[model samples]
Target: MSIIGTIYEDVTTDVLGHIGSWQWLVTFISATLMVPSMLNQYEDMFLLEPPREIECDVSASSSVFNTSLCTYSVLNGTKVYKCTTWHVKFLWMIWFKKSWLIFCDHKIKLLSTTIICRLGLVFGCIIFGLIADSFGRKLAISIDVVAELGFRLILTFCDSESWFLLLIFLRSLFASANIYMGIILTCEIASSSWRTLLNAVVSIPRMLSAVCLVPLANVAPNSETFNFIACIFSASLLILLRWTPESPQWLLYNRGIPKAEKTILRAAKING
Candidate 1:
């Protein structure tokens, strides 16, 4: 896409933010932020420090099922337990050792963050749905932006598994709401003929953001830096919102014809 194409898409996305394209980027970053939490699954399996030579006394155990009866020891008189040194390529699980997955290899812990994220999506939809209905699309998006940024900022400094999980849930909730609200606003505001093109254009950013995650994770020094980057990107949207206008349709329906007409007229003047 050319600079003009990028500008067009961005302008279109902001215009549609009340109804459509802007949320595509929100969804992308939101989903990207949550991905780091699940990195522990890979870390637990592949990134742990290698254990020293192990001496297992299984000769005393006659049953194959009774592995508990077997006694094991480290040849160097040191116990090989949870990993202290991470693979370094993954780079950040060391900060999260107090979390449940750090001490034990539980399958439930592996799935918990993903599961919580889904739960947040469900809750976010329900909550933001009502908010958009009661307030207006622009206000709803503003709230989502703030919530996502604040939670992500907090997530950067978070150490506990519970706090990390909670922040992700909160952040994803806003993410889901932002996507839903943005799509609705776009669909509501754009002409019926132009809707498809707007949606396709916005989706490009979402795909690019998804592809950037691997490099983002690899290049970031730690979870804090990773989250800080997300916060900065999210904060930039606030500046972008200055160019985004309120939805005339929403204004008409909720604030009456006068406000709606004024907004429409202002938009026309800006476009002209």
Candidate 2:
């Protein structure tokens, strides 16, 4: 809990200190490290003895993952299926709640979610890439962010398991699309030569978040709070709208120079 409190405070301070750069640095680093392996660094340290419950925990997590994956897929694209939202929310509760309060709850489910989160993230990025190329970076960013926000809000308020499940499905659905979208969209905003470097830099946060920052999740009280932390992280990235712009490619292709200039300038300032 202390760890999470410190990180939570640090995130706030990081945001205030570097509206454009440092905050994003943290974001980039964490997002770059967005794999389960990053946070598992210490499991071997303190809990190395491998508690007896670990086996049961692993088994349960696997089962939940398998089951939920199906549930999420079925309802994610279907807005009419209300149960989808509930399951999604439930996953957050299971993940962030870290409930010793429920079935085999310890680090198992959290670890599983952390593991799967970025897998979903990877797919999300790819989907966004397509959107950016087809629909335009600005539109992709806006749509992804809005959908992300809506999912978070819905999950945050949902009280029932059914509601939470649906929320989780919605969040994961969009998030899977968002990870790649952020990547392709940001790249579109940069200069051609610089695109590679900036795009690479943007990926740094997934790593940092996963490795250096995510363990703090262990310090948080529950899944709900963790979801909020993740939400804040996502929102911070979205707030880049003040500085973000439609990719110059789209502008160039569309033959809009004056329009592309400002976005180019901002990218240069931040990324240069």
Candidate 3:
């Protein structure tokens, strides 16, 4: 067996011989607290998109304007006037439209921002995966959570489209890291018998987070207020993570058997 595998076996056999309360506690906390982070990250796709139905009014022309087109022709003339304002249906105040002024002409730019933010999910997995292996799962999750919250809060105040897109990209990047590393830590700390069940439990929050957003969006006055409420949830997760224990598997491989043993004992104490 490899070094980590050997250490994992020893810790599971000699120290954490059976599933205990500490394992269950970690599983529940991680699963519950993760919902907010998942919602905050995944909601970007919905929020970045412009409302489906839009109509434009021309100030100087009495022509019938096509809702699909960005510009319209006058009744008796060939002059095409650009739409300066839009009448949007469904969601009237999405931050993407209000803050950036991304009308029909700027649909491409809106799509680009959505694509860029989503790309963070792919990169965050690869990058934070390495960080988890090298540093420790606990540290990796903590750093990502802090970064995610910081970027999200900063994004609320951003006025420029370029800066807003950049913040959303970075926010998504770290938000993914928080979830990825959190799952890793949860699995690493859990016993082999409990691993599959805990993983399933953790995944439930992802679906629930999406459901939760429906109510949140309806209650909040605007997109900025909605974002602020989401950030509050992220902040609460940070606090909960403080009591969470590091993975004995990671400590054994990186910090030697003594440290790993210490962590196991501490968890045992908590379990008792």
Which is superior by TM-score, 1 or 2? 1
Q: Estimate each model's TM-score.
A: 0.64, 0.50, 0.75
Highest TM-score model number: 3
Q: What is the lDDT of residue 74 in candidate 3?
A: 63
lDDT of 1: 0.51
Model 1: per-residue Cα lDDT over 1-272, one tens digit each: 00122233344435444333333333343333333233322222321232212122333434422222122333445553442222221223332222222223355764676678678878887887887777776676777777767887887666567777787788777765555455565554555456665555545544554555455455555445456766777777676556555555666556466776666555544444
- Quote the lDDT for 163 in model 2: 51
Question: What is the full ranking by TM-score, best candidate first?
Answer: 3, 1, 2
Q: Over 4 Å off in model 2, which ranges? A: 1-127, 189-196, 233-238, 254-258, 261-272
lDDT for each residue of candidate 3 in 111-190, tens digit (9 for 90 to 100):
78778877877787777788778877777678777886787678655656678777877877776665655566677777
> How many clashes does each candidate structure show, in the order listed?
9, 49, 0
State the weakest 10-residue window (summed lDDT) of model 1: 46-55
Give per-residue CA lDDT, model 2, range 34-142, as digits (tens): 3322222322222222221111122233223223221322323432211122222332344222212212235675455444544545556667667666667667656
Give Cα distance to truth, residue 76, candidate 1, Å: 2.2
